[model samples]
Target: MQAASFTGILKAIFYMIAFYYIFRFLAKLFLPLLVKKVVEKAGQKFQQQQQHSQENPWNKTTAKDEVIYNTANTKNPRETKKVGEYVDYEEID
Candidate 1:
């Protein structure tokens, strides 16, 4: 069996550090582009939804479809009823 050597351990550490820096560099270059594309797609979807809402017929209100509620003739249904008599108790210390 071949025992681990100092050079082999150093080579492994170097490879790990190189891989980390390379990944960081690539992410810095491409991450913004990926995020920009996502944001633009979301903005387009939001604009489409706004346009759809504006063009919908049910969202428009007209004079004939207006509703008015008369509250003056309404009766109050929440008349309070007594359930039990209150009993006061003195604290004995």
Candidate 2:
């Protein structure tokens, strides 16, 4: 009876460890899907802002999403912001 209980407990522990790794693998796989959703939402927001600006021609607000991104590799800090037809300066103290 004791041997049977020990075997059952060992099986249960093995199953628990397997389940934990499976969960981690699934989460890693779905991470890109989550990122894609976020990027799509950002694009929609940018489009709405563009349409609103078109309706109000007098508004001089710049489009934040006009920037293009290369998902390959980009590490330059300045590359994050779009270099539009205007100047943006930050004071360095």
Q: Which structure among the candidates has the greatest TM-score? A: 1
* Model 2 worst lDDT run, 10 consecutive residues: 72-81
Off by over 4 Å in 1: 60-74, 77-93
lDDT of 1: 0.92
lDDT of all predictions = 0.92, 0.87
Instruction: Give me the displacement of residue 53 in model 2, in angstroms.
Output: 3.8
Q: Relative to the unseen true structure, what is the C-alpha lDDT of residue 69 in candidate 2, on a scale of 0 to 100?
A: 80
Model 2: runs farther than 4 Å from truth? 1-4, 57-93
